[model samples]
Target: MDNIYIYMLIALAFLAVADLVVGVSNDAVNFLNSAIGSKAISFKTIMIVASLGVALGALSSSGMMEVARKGIFNPGEFMFDEIMIIFTAVMITDILLLDFFNTLGLPTSTTVSIVFELLGASVCIAILKISADDSQSLLHLGEYINNSKALEIILGILLSVVIAFSIGAIIQFFARLLLSFNFQNKPSWYGAIFSGIAVSSILYFILVKGVKNATFMPDTLKDLVSSSPFQVIGVSFLLFTVISYLIIKFTKNNIYTIIIIIGTFALAVAFAGNDLVNFIGVPIAAFNSYEAWSASGVLPSNYAMVALNQPVGTKPILLLIAGLIMVLTLWFSSKAKAVVKTSVDLSRQDNVKERFEPNFLSRSIVRLSMTASEKFNSLLTPGSKRFIDKQFAKPVQALKTKSEDMPAFDLVRAAVNLMVASILISLATSMKLPLSTTYVTFMVAMGTSLADRAWGSESAVYRVAGVLNVIGGWFFTALSAFVAAAIMAIVLYYGRVYALTGLLILAIVLLIKNYLSHKKQSREQKEADSLERSESSSTQGVIIESAKNISNVVKRGNKIYSSAINGLATQDLKALKKNKKNITKLSNEIDDLRDNIFYFIKNLEEPSLAASNFYINILSFLQDMAQSLDYISSVSYKHIHNNHKKLKFTQIKELQEIDAVMETLFGDIKSAFASNSFTEIGTILAEKKSIINLVTEKIQKQVERTRSEESSPKNTTLYFSMLLETKDLLNATMNLLEEYHSAHDEKVAPARLPGSADPSLEEE
Candidate 1:
């Protein structure tokens, strides 16, 4: 029995390390998003600063471990064995929940997960204790739980979301008004003041509020900070203001960049100090419980976990090891980058590819906002409104910059994001609230973007949808964490060692599966022969770029057409389902290409205005082909999915023959486009009549079969639908070839008509 406890301890040690890796992956975005979004400094520099903050913050995190030990539940109420079960359950649930969110690239609160997991597991154990005792009843459950602290932590975290967003928005609106979009041309003193306030706020919260809880802080300094925080604030503000002014006056360096660098470090420190407990606190508490049990010389079931109720200091070495793991994860984890990208994309100042789609709620919100804006503007004087418009007007340079070089937002917004998020998170840490870093940072970024008008009419709906999706996921995290941890506690309580072995195996399998799935998805995105947009400015450049897209479309469209025929003939439902997905993806790629037509035209050289016509025609033909294929795939899949009868043998054979001929034509078209041999397109055009006739013949045969030998009305309908769509599909493919062939002819023809051989037709 004692040996099993030792094994549990070993398992927990590993879980703690694993939890740190996953927790950091989700939380890295909290500190890194602002600097990365603004492009304030080199990424290497940001990481170095953040890494240092994490190292120091981990050392200070010793005080936070109390939350996991006794903050969520009354630990003295549980025997050592029961306490172990609760701890084990919480660790398993926390790691899995955080990893799941990370894999989805959505930032969720690690603080919320850890707190709820502890609450759930302990509550489960408490219920068992009450049920087994004759005197103890349902009313006695509160004695086993720290309901007051649990409620406070939950309420604090929820309240922080609203507070962070409001403060961020108000500060940003004023900051933008003060600096305007042309802040770079403003007087040096203007920037110095902004930088001074931003940097000073970060320092005060991180040093006074955050560091006052550090294990290594001297008593005198903590006392000084606690007793005279206002004095510290005033002095720091004055000192940083002078320093900022000197830097601006003496050098060409941007002061906002300096603030972002310092702010990143401050937030990183606060994250580690507040969130480290979410990762390792449970395991450390478990270790302490085991020590107490062993030394008592009593059976584990009989020994109470009284030691957990008192304060216990965490070993510095353990904190250091956990910090090292987090720093490394911050530097290397691809998931961390993905989570950061989500926040940055949502808050970007200009449009890029939106990762989410608009929903009804988002649409309604945008409409209401527009209505309110109109009403608000009616209340403003004309002069005031004009002044506000001028202040918010973005510079022309912001519009012309290349996408890869453009920052997500200006440095001012980034500074505000960092300053607000760091202050809020550090303040929570000071009060021992364990407020969610993810929640505070993410909402602050969103709020700043909203205030800066980054979410313009073109992007407002999609951005709102993305925000709502993420918020929905957070609520899911809380409920799922509570339920899962409770269930795990029950299993561990009764099944003991066998249950532990099964769960460990299950966790290993799930982690491996998620990693491989993410890797495969990344590889597919890179290697897929998807359609691409034309970025060419000249006619010749457009021809080359657009030809590549045409070739890819032809190649993919061929496979999808063929798959539909084959899957239908065999009634292979799985293959048909996959074929539907393939066709839809191809169709969406074409749509994306069409969406870039505005930019394509804008980028065209004056001499290449004709190229726009050719490009648009090519896209239209490609869309036609995709629409045909999409219809075919959809109807085919629907037929098989409904368990409708397969087509008759003759009908199947005729469709297969059409598929073969269509495949040959598509192969020829693909080859012509791929090699830039527009001459071959002429040959493909010649066979267009034959291919269309073949599809017509299939339609005719299906009609005859339907009229005479068709026994099932459903089969007749499906066969006729496939035949007709195949005919449309052939026409679209042939039209694309014809269009390409004609464009080639126009390219190679003499600049003047053949009649220009006459001297009068020639230019003087």
Candidate 2:
């Protein structure tokens, strides 16, 4: 039993490190999103600045360690053994929960998870204690819990969401109104004043609020800040204002960019300073309890954890090591980039791909907002309206830039996002509230985006939906954390060494599973034969791009069509289901190409304007082909999934025959497009009639079977459907081939290749 505790301690130390990795992966979005979104500075510089902040912030996080010990529960009420169980449960739960969120690329609150885990685990252990004592009832559970502090932390986290958003929106609205989109051309004083306010706020929080909690700081310095915070603020403001003015006048750099850089550093510090307890605090507390027990030479269960109730400083070496792990994770974690991308995509200024779909709630919110805006505008005079409109107008050059090259938003909005998040997080940290940096940073970014009018009518509902989904995930985090930690506590308390071993194994397995799953998903995305949007401005350029896409489509389409036929032949539901997924991916790729038609048309050169027509026709045919495949996959999977009667042998044979012929034809089509052999397409087009005849013959034979030998209506209906859709598929494929061949002939003479330069073909 004595040896078991040592192993538990070792396990805890490992869990602490794992928790830090996953926790940082999720929370990196809190500090990284604003700088990464603005694109004001090179990525290397922003990361170096953020890395420094995280390092210092982790060092200053010692005072917060007490929260994990006695903030949620009355540690003195539990024995050393029970306390160990609770700590183990919390660490286990935290690692799994945070990693789950990181894997999904959603930002969730580590503060909420750690806080609720402590509460849940303690409550579970307390309940067992109460049950063991006949004198104590369930109501006496309050004696073991710190209800007030727990409630305060919970409410503070929930309230930060609303407060952060409101403040962010109000500040960003005014900032945009003051600076406008073309703030670069503003007077030097205007830029200096803005820079002054932003820099002063960041510095005040970083020095006064952040350093106040550092374990290494001298008592006199803490006392000085405790006495004259306002004095410190005034001096900082005056000094930075002069500095800002000098920088703006002497150099041509943008002040908002400087603010963004400072804000990134500030938020990183705030996150590490405040949220570090959520990762390592439990293990440190458990280690202290063990030391207190070992020193007393008392039995583990009989030795009460009175030592944990008192505040103890963490070793600076441990903090440094933890900080080192965080910085490494910040730099190298792919999941961190994913979580940051989610935040940036939601707040991008221009229309781009939306990861979330608009739901009814999002749609209603957008509608009500539009109606309110109209009502408010009715009260403004024409001049006032025109002035406001001009101030909100985006620059034409920005609109014309490719979305990949354009920043997610301008530096002013980015500055507001950072400054607002920094203030809220700093305030919460100074008060030792364990405020959720994830909530503060994410909502602030969203609010700033709304104020900056990044959520236009076209994207407003989708963006709103993404926001609502994230908020919903936050609430889910709290609920799940509480339930899961409580369950783990009970298991650990009863099973002891056995339960700990099982859970450690389970956590390891789950972490490995998530890792492999994410890697597989990323690999598929990178290597998948997905269609690409055309970025060309010439007919020849369009042809080259479209040829690659057409080849990809036909290649994937062949596999999907053959899978549906084979699945129907064998009645393999699992194969059919996977085949449906593949086809859907193909369909979605085609849909994405269709969505890019606007940009494709806009990018075309004037002389090659005719290529737009040719490109549109190709997409239409491709879409038709995809739809045919989608229908085939859907019905095939549905028939098998619903346990419908399998087709007879003769029916299966006929379908397989059709599949063989179509496979040959699609192979030739893919080869033609892949090799850019437009002339070979003429042969495929000539053979298209034979393919259609084969499908027609299949349908005629299926009808005769239905009239005479067919017993199942489901089979007959399915057979007829497959034959007809296959006919449509063949026609769409041939139409695409003919369209390409005709366009090739018109552009290049019969004596030359498709892209050969011909004097007669040049419009000029």
- Candidate 2 Cα lDDT to native: 0.86
Best by TM-score: 2
Where is the poorest 10-residue window by lDDT in model 2? Answer: 755-764
Q: Each candidate: what lDDT?
A: 0.84, 0.86
Q: Which pairs in model 2 have colliding backbones?
A: none
Please give the distance, in angstroms, between residue 428's alpha carbon in candidate 2 and its true position after superposition.
3.4
Counting clashing residue pairs in each candidate, in order, gives: 0, 0
Q: Deviation in angstroms for 590 in model 2?
A: 1.9
User: What C-alpha lDDT does candidate 1 achieve relative to the native structure?
Assistant: 0.84
Candidate 1 lDDT, tens digit per residue, 137-213?
Answer: 99998998888987787687678778988898889999989999898888888998888788878988787645667
Error of 1 at 296 (Å): 0.7
For model 1, which pairs clash?
none
